[model samples]
Target: MTALGTYVKVWLALIALTGLTVTAAGLHLGSLSVLAAILIASVKSSLVLSFFMNLRSEERVFKVMLGVAMATMAVIMLLTFVDVWYR
Candidate 1:
């Protein structure tokens, strides 16, 4: 497929994911709600990073740096959640 077509498809997928996020938010899943939202957001962000940001075409070092940054963010989020849960 052409780049425009690919972008259109990605845009549609992102829209669908956004809808899913909204639907998930309306439900009463308690602890799982946050997990569902985070998972959906992660998927959306990855799609944006890979397609819109053109990260797939970048060098390995850039990908590695992004990975490190993502990992650090994940750690911080995890720590925050843990602290909140204990409170």
Candidate 2:
């Protein structure tokens, strides 16, 4: 697909994800609601990183770095959750 076509598709996906995020917020799922929102936000961020940021064409090192960063953030989030749960 052309650049414009790809961008349009990503834009549409972002819009749909945004709507889903809003809908998820309205529901009373307690702890699951936070997880759902985080998962949806992660998907949206991944789409933006892969498409809008043109990360697909980036070098392997950059991709690896991004992965490490994401992993680190995940670990931190998990720690926070554990701490909160124990308290």
Candidate 3:
């Protein structure tokens, strides 16, 4: 597909994901609701980073930096969840 087509597809996917996030928020899943939201947000972010940010066409170092940043965020989120679970 062309660049414009690819962008359109990604935009559509983002809109669908946003709708899903809103629907998930309206449900009563307790702690799972937060997890679902986070998962959806992560997917959305990845799509934006890979396409809209043009990361896929960038150098290997940029991808490594992005991975490191994502890993650090995951670690922080895991620690927070662990602390909350014990409380």
Candidate 2, residues 1-87, lDDT tens digits: the string is 337999999999999999998999999888999999999998999999989988988889989999899899999999999999998
Per-residue alpha-carbon lDDT of model 1 for 1-87, expressed as tens digits?
238988999999999999999999999899999999999999999999989888888899989999899899999999999999998
Stretch of 10 with least lDDT, candidate 2: 1-10
Runs in model 1 deviating more than 4 A are: 76-87
lDDT of 3 by residue, 1-87 (tens): 337999999999999999999999999899999999999998999899989998888899999998899899999999999999998
Any runs in candidate 3 off by more than 4 Å, and if so which?
A: 73-87
- For residue 69, give model 2's deviation from the true position in Å: 2.3
Please provide the root mean square deviation of candidate 1 (C-alpha atoms, Å): 2.6
Ranked by TM-score, top first: 1, 3, 2
- What's model 3's overall lDDT? 0.94
Deviation of model 3 at 62, angstroms: 0.4
Q: For model 1, what is the error of residue 84's alpha carbon versus the real structure, in angstroms, after optimal superposition?
A: 6.2
Choose 2 or 3, whichever is better by lDDT: 3
